[model samples]
Target chain A: MTASIRQMGVITAHLIRKVAFNPAVVWLIAMPLVIIYILGITMHGLFSAEFTPVKPYRIVVALPEEAGFLVERISRAPKHFAVEEARDAQEARQAVFQRQADAAIVAADGDEPLTVIAPPGSIVLEMLAGVVQASLEQEAQQVAAAQPPVENGSREESDTGARSAGAADGALSAMPWEGVGSFEYFSIGLIVMFMAFASHSAMVHCVQDRSTGAYLRIRALGVTRAVYLGAGITSGMLLGAGFSLVMAVITWTLFRVVWGNAAAWALMTIAGAASVASLSFLLTALLPSDPKGVENAGGTVYSLLAFFGGSTVPLTIMPRWFSEIFSWLPNRKMLDGYLKIVKGAGVKEIEQELFGLAAAALIMLGLAWLVVMLLKREEV
Target chain B: MATHAAVQEARGQAAGDPSIVVEGLRKSFGKNVAVDGLSFTVHPGEIFGLLGPNGAGKSTTLSIMAGLIRPDSGDVKIGGHSVIRETQRAQRLMGVVPQGLAVYEELTAAQNLDYFAKLRGIEKKRRRQEIEEILELVGLSGVAHRKVAQYSGGMKRRLNVGIGLLGRPRVLLLDEPTVGIDPQSRRHILDSVRRLAESGMAVVYTTHYMEEVEYLCSRLAIIDRGRVIAHGPIDEVRALAGDAVVLRLPFPRGVLDEAAKVESLQNTLPMPVEVTSGELRIVLPQGSRQAPAVIEELQRHGVPLDGMRLESPNLETVFLSLTGKALRDGKAAEEGAMA
Candidate 1:
């Protein structure tokens, strides 16, 4: 294991020197910053003008200890919903009753159903109730499947084992935040997009190695194929993730864009790096060891992922089917998570996006391994 | 006192002990049969050469020994470690200098050596010293800090050889390491390989140039169409080549119609005669004894013959006489190279 790690370290250094020393790397990093600035300034007005062209529905929420996860699930994810924390259930209900807030949700703490407060015939009333009922119904079914038929267990709809795990970390503080500015949104989107491109560009080393027979040389020098490939992927991931973080810092310092909590942004950047690196590895391994083939395939995949995933073209301008179908792309997931962070969401709120990115990395890595094994078998 | 000299001595095994054992190797690339039941062994402190025309499976055989390709039926053992079953350990005992330049162009020569040394599991502290010594050995110490992209072809080839010298393995496999280079650089590489063998490292040298094999290797195998046509010490292989002498008779380009003259010679002369690019060669069945009869016959055919020379049995002669094809068959070699 020590020898493997040492080999990985050496291969990483080789890759870094090979990739970072090239003059084109300067353009690869600098171009994105320029594009983000220009596009942000150009598209400022479009983002400012929402479809409704009215104030967002102000939903005053009261989390009774255990229901923070459900309220965050329901209140978050939609940029159009603005949230405010009510001090207590009475205050939440009174504020809506007195016409100060559009709606209020008093979540169930333990053994008690949630309460909803809204004016009659108000759109917020029906929307909030319907979302909360759907969540409660899902929770009810989970409770039913987890336990035997106990009449008293029905009231156990409080924060369960899974939801309470986040409590120790602290409450899910969905701070009062406004929507992202055009510059901030574009900066995050382009950073994610360029990071993927950067990973693909980093793979030029592997292509050159293969053509020059350096890969076979390295393997003959006692390094396994897996170790050589892993070193490349890990090194590219670090370089790409570091580059994205630097971009975030630059935007935050220069354009005054808030990328949410630092820890969350860093995690999201690492996750994005893993996904892009694995995608590059799989593409290289699956192709016919030709640089042009890898390049063309990567270019097509990157372009499509960005086009439909809100990086190249905004989801607002995309067709509904595109929005529905391609929204699950890794790039799309990254952009969505980054936009939320820009909107002041933290690690807890973007947990699913983080999980999705991690899962994508694992799946790509697994597929790359499978392809390499098949090729080796055929060679044998 | 330097790390390279010390490492060389410390890692050096006893000379004349077999370090490579290739047994019944068979590999077929979709029916091409790259290496068919080939076998050989090389001992420490000896240079074993494999000579064959293009596509004679020289590179493929070296690749199998380097653990890059898996043979269909047999195995290569590096100092008792199986290249197939214990590939990593076997690889650690051997190094491969590939036909192409494997050094990274973006990195300095020293940097390339240092990175490969590290990947070879040399500790960080010893890596700098080892890399410096390697640069000195490859005659690149003066320009070690320059990127390989800026180096001349000979310098790049030298660095390619230097990378294979990283771990001081028991065996080294060099597949035409000096294909196209300045004569001085080629000389330096040959001297370095000699020094390596002196330090008790077994070297497997493959080349198209027969003189290189005669100058460096004590034993060699002549492979033809994925099979060993001749194998043994230099004298033994030459003995197998027989006492048949090659007679080179030159003629002005336009003076001889190659096709008509070749037909005329084949029909009239009672010897194996072939027309090459610039000359006609007739192999004397019996040494210089048959030379006069061949000359008289050529003269009787109204063939204008320049001063002819009788070339005795050598590696090239052995290769041609055994394989029935010139060692450097120009057209076939070009096509093989392109492939």
Candidate 2:
């Protein structure tokens, strides 16, 4: 017992020296930091843009009767526009085409038929067009009422309001990126990418040690299997946490993005790393003794998992069945949980996801332990 | 002079207990039996050599003693502690130098020693001193700060020896200690072992190198097929092949006519002379006076001797007599299988 404990201390010291001083060890640690730095820089702009206070859209109205209400709604609405009125439809079109106004509303026939126009693919224009069209349609229906105008009681106004509300909901739902910027989406994807690289590299080290007779040497020193594996997971955790933090800082400095609570984020970093370490150990153990076997099997497993886990595609956009399948992949659970934490989710909000990640980590670590125990029993 | 002084000190302290004893050890790996019903005892202050071919169970026996591998059936006692029952206690009394260079390549030699010394629970104050002493003892002081990866094979082997000596166990088990070392490093290692023995460390050295056994071991066991074929003093072991004087003489012309003269010469000389092929090999009853008379008889017959080799038996003949084949042939066969 004393021998084992003393050996553990020795092994720990070596681990520190390897991670702290050796170039290979430094590179193992530094590679993740570099990725984090790159991702933080790359994704910072997107997060800031997603959450930034949106500016009002400039508009021009070319309608005579219905245009009055359109201009009022454009000017007075909570998040609609900066209002302007063009003399005619031609002038309004010119305003939009010349980039002077983001959108224009023209009243065309009796009861004032409305034609809403904006620059193609312009987010501000798209929102403004929907807003102006709703106001104009309301005014047109108000004039069509046959009964006395009762205060807040016209059936046509209520009907148009309901339709407008439904249309507004549809428009918002159509563009997912409108609410979540491209940077946030990219940041989430980079987290998974970093994990993949870290896990793969960790497995490579395991294979090297096994084949090179180093494992046998260490075993002969009375270093138990548990100590050996615990050190491995510890190394992986250090790598993952160091990587995630660098990436987070870089993300903040470059994008001016704000992340969640520091404590929550710290737990996320540790959990994420533990999950990756488990995965790396599982994959390394699954690989046959042949060097080429790892390449072949690892390629298939990585590709399939990355595809399903939203590393390459957003899980939200994937088919319902595909998403359901992804729930089974530990990578998906971790990435989902990590993204939620990074996206400013509170502990209560991400509790279920965190539990799921923890469960997967434990299962994977348990499996790795079993496999390693079996392997140890075989030869050395 | 130092060796004499150390040996004198050892004699004063040498106690009644045997250092290591193995009885009826049996171990099998899958279908192959590694050590089968093997047994031996190593007394204090003796260099006991385990000599055999590659698969002759030498390594298995050493590993069992070192507590690295569990024996299927056996009783191994180190300083009166059962290896299986009191492994840590038994291991505390022993140090093992494995066949492979087990030193960490990423660490400096001193760092490697320091790490292992700490594992062995050497006092913090004494650890550095002991590491430096072992480094100097192994003649690796100048290069102690260099990472083991930069070391030549011989340097690594020497460091392997140094680590085994760090805890200063009562018994040191070295598996091919001089293997892969340069001639200088090899000599340095052998001398270190000699020093340890003189200082009263019972050493169990396993190797296929007979010259090493002859040079370093006072007693040896010739093992084959996982069994000890012979074990005793080196001279006693070699005596299994009777006393024979080997003469490297010129090929005699009249082989059949010389046979009659050699027989007549045998009656007059103190030893019996037999001519096989070209050389006259004489088996003495046990006297040195026969050589002069044999030389005179060969001269009388005009045997025209070009050269002569006269010596008592050695391990080579002993090994051949026991195995019915040379040790080298058996080692070649084992290497072939491994390759």
**Candidate number achieving the greatest TM-score relative to the actual structure:** 1
Question: Taking the tens digit of each residue's C-alpha lDDT, what string does model 1 give over A1-380?
Answer: 88888888888877876667778778877887888888888766546633331466777887664566566666663654577888987787677767777777665455444555655323354345445655665566776665312112121112110111111112112211125677887787788888887787667577768778798798888777767888889877987887787788888887898777888888888898999999998888887378788888888988877777777665533323455576668887788788888787799988988999999999999998898888755332
Tens digits of per-residue lDDT for model 2, A161-224:
1122223334344332334544455555565566555545545554555554345445544555
Interface RMSD, all candidates in order, equals: 1.6, 3.4
Can you tell me which runs of candidate 1 are displaced by over 4 Å?
A50-179, A378-380, B1-16, B247-310, B329-339
For model 1, how does the per-residue alpha-carbon lDDT over B118-176 read when each residue is reduced to its tens digit?
Answer: 78888777888888888998999999999888998889988999899887778999998
Local distance difference test values of all predictions, in order: 0.76, 0.66
Instruction: Write down the C-alpha DockQ for each prediction.
Output: 0.44, 0.14
Interface quality of candidate 1 as DockQ: 0.44
lDDT, candidate 1, residue B2? 46
Best by DockQ: 1
**Maximum-lDDT candidate:** 1
Q: How accurate locally is residue B228 in candidate 2, as Cα lDDT from 0 to 100?
A: 86
Question: Chain A of candidate 1: what's the TM-score?
Answer: 0.65
